[model samples]
Target: MPTEVLHRLSTLSLTSVKQLGRLPRLSSSLPALPAPRPTLAASEVPTLFREPHILSGYRPAGQPWSSYLLSTFQWHNESMNVWTHLLAAPLLLLRCWSLLEGAGGPWRLLGDVAALPLVLYVVSALTYLACSVAAHLLQSRSELTHYSVFFLDYVGVAVYQYGCALGHYFYGSEPRWRDDILGGLMGAVYLPSAALLAWMSCACCCFAKAHYRRPYPPRRKVVQLIPTGLAYVLDISPVAHRLLVAGDWQRDDDGALGFHAAQVVFFMMAAMFFSYPFPECCLPGHCDIIGHAHQLFHFFLALCTVCQLEALFRDFLARRAAILDVHGGELVVGAGVSFFVLVLCCLATAVWMRRTVQKRLKDQQA
Candidate 1:
C-alpha cells in the first residue's frame, strides 16, 4: 500500500498526461483502420444525357471541365470512343510523315504527284480524328460544350470529305484544264452540299435538343442521316463516274480502283454501325465501356481513311507518266495553294462556330 500509494501519487493527474497516454493508442488504431478512399463529389460524377438503354451500362451525365478532362483516365461509355480516335490521330500523323519522306528524294516524281494530295488526305483524316476525340471527351462538360464540339466534329467530317473530293479531283485525273473544269464542277456541286449538310447538322443539334432524348425518334434518325447520305453521294459520284468511263472493273492493274471499292465498303460499314447501334442494341449495357457500335464506327472510319490513302498512293503511281510530263513547279504551287485554302476555310469555320456558341451561351445565361 505504501509503495503503490506513493507511485500513484507520483503519477501526474494533469489532463495533458492523460491525453498523452491516449495518443499512442489513437496512432496505432489509425494504422489498423483502412485509409479513406478518394471519392467524387456527387455533383462531380456526371449524369446521362441520353437514355440508359440507348447507351446501355453506366454513362456520365454533365460534369465540369476539370472533371470531364479527368474522366479520360476512368472507365466510362465514351472512353473507347475518345481513345479510338485519339490513338489513331498520332498513328495517322506518323504514317503521313513516313509517306511524305518516302515520296521525296530520288522519287521526286512520286512526290510531285502524291505529296500534296497525300498530305492533304492525311491532314484531313487527322482533323476528323482530332475533332472526334474532342467531341467525345468533352461531351459531358455542358450542353453548350457538347453542341459546340459536335458542331465542330461535323464540320471536320465535311472538311475531310471535301478534301477527299479535292484530292481525287486534283491528283486522280490528268493535269488538264478539262479535268480541272470537271473537278471544279464536281466540287461546286458537292462542296456546297457538304457545307449545307454541316449547317443543317449544327442547326439540328442546336434546335432539336429534345430529339436526342428517348426511343431514338424516326424523324431524328432520318434527319441525322441526311448529312451522311450527302457525304456518300459526294464521295461516290466521282468514283462511280471514273469507273464508268474506265469501263473495266476487272482490270485494275494497280488495284487503286479495288482499294477505292474497299474504302467505300469500310465507309458503309462505319455508317451502318453509326446508324444501327448494333450489338449494343441487342445486348444493352454489356458493351457500354468497350465494344459499342460508336466505337466500331470509329474503327471502321479509320480503316476507311487508310483505304483512301492507299488508293491515293496507287493513283499517284498509275498517273506517274502524265504527272512527270507536267511542270513540277506549277503543280506544286497549285497543290500548295489549294491545301492552304482548305486549311484556312476549316479554321475560319471553327472560329465562327466557337464565337456563335459562346454568344448563344451568354444569351442563355443572361
Candidate 2:
C-alpha cells in the first residue's frame, strides 16, 4: 500500500510540470493575439494644430497641392506680403497708361517715352509678386523651391532699378546750361539708385543661396558668377554721350559703367539702413502687414523719383530759358538743395535701420 501511494505522488508532480510548460504558451499567445492596435496618441499630431479634427490625418509631407492650398487659406505671415505689391501692379499700369494718353502726338505714339521705364517697373513688380506668391505657397514644399524663388525676386528688384536709371539718363534732357546742370543732378540721383539695386540683388542672391539650401546643394561656382554678372551689367550704363549729342553711340562709355558702379556701392551703404536688419527690423511681421523695410525702401525710391522729376522740370525751364526767357539759375539751386536733403534722409534711414536691427538681434540672442 505504501509503494502504490509514492508512485501516485510522482505521477501528480509530472502533471504539474506539464501544466507549467503549457502556461508559458498561453501567455505568449496573448502577445501574438495583437495587443490592441495602438490608437494614435494626442502627442502624435503636429504641434501647430490646435485640435485633432483640424489635422484630420493630414500631414503636408511631399504634397505640392496641399502646400499651395495652405498658402491661401492658412493665416501665414506671408499672406499680406504677397498681396500688397500685387495690387500695386494694376495701379502702376493705370498710371502709366494715363500719362501716355495725356502726352499726345509723338509722345503718345512712343507710349510716353517713359513707358520703357514703366515696363521695367511693371515687370519687376510682377516678378516680385510672383516670387512672393511662390515663396508663400511653395517654400514650405521644399528647401530647393524657396531659395530659387527668393533669388529671382531679388534679381527683379535690381533689374527694375537699372531700368529706372537708364530712363532718367535718356529722358531728363533740356537745351540750356541750367538744363545741363539739372540733367547732371537727375543722373546722379538715378545712377546711384541703379547701382544700389544691382548690389542688393547680387548680395542677397549669394547670401541667401549659400545659407538657405543645405540638403540640396547648388554649384557654388555658378552662383559666384551671378554677382560678377550683376556688377558687369549694372556698371555698364546704357547711356552713351554720343547717343545724347547725335542720337546714337560712336564709342560706348565703358569707363562710365565702372564709375557708376562705385557710386552704387556708396548708396548701398546709405540704403543699408533700410534692408540691413531686414525682416527682423522692418520686414518681419510689421513689414508683412504694411510698414516694412521694403515699403520704406520703396518710399525712399519714390522720393528719389520726385527729386529726379523736379530736376527734369528745372532742366526743361533752363532749356526753355535758353530758347525763351526764364530764371534757370534759381531753379537749378533749388533742385540741388532738394537732392542734398534726399541723400541726407537716405543716410539717416540707413542709420536708423542699423540701430533697429542691432536691437532686434540683441533681443533674439537674449
The candidate scoring highest on TM-score is 1
After superposing candidate 1 on the true structure, give the runs of residues whose Cα lies further than 4 Å from its correct spot. Answer: 1-48, 51-67, 101-114, 173-216, 243-245, 248-251, 320-366
| Per-model TM values vs. the true structure | 0.69, 0.41
**Model 1: lowest-lDDT 10 consecutive positions:** 31-40
User: Model 1, clash count?
Assistant: 4
| Residue lDDT tens for model 1, 1-366 | 123322322341232236335544553443221113222222344442453343432334444466666655555667677766776676566555565567563356444443565566666788888888988888766666766777678667766776686556545543233245456464344545544554454444433432354444677777767765866675566565656565546666766776677677878899898888787778876776678788889877876776677667767666655653553546545655655665566556656766776786689689
lDDT computed for candidate 2? 0.39
Q: Against the unseen true structure, what C-alpha lDDT does each candidate score?
A: 0.60, 0.39
**Which candidate gets the maximum lDDT versus the true structure?**
1
TM-score of 2: 0.41
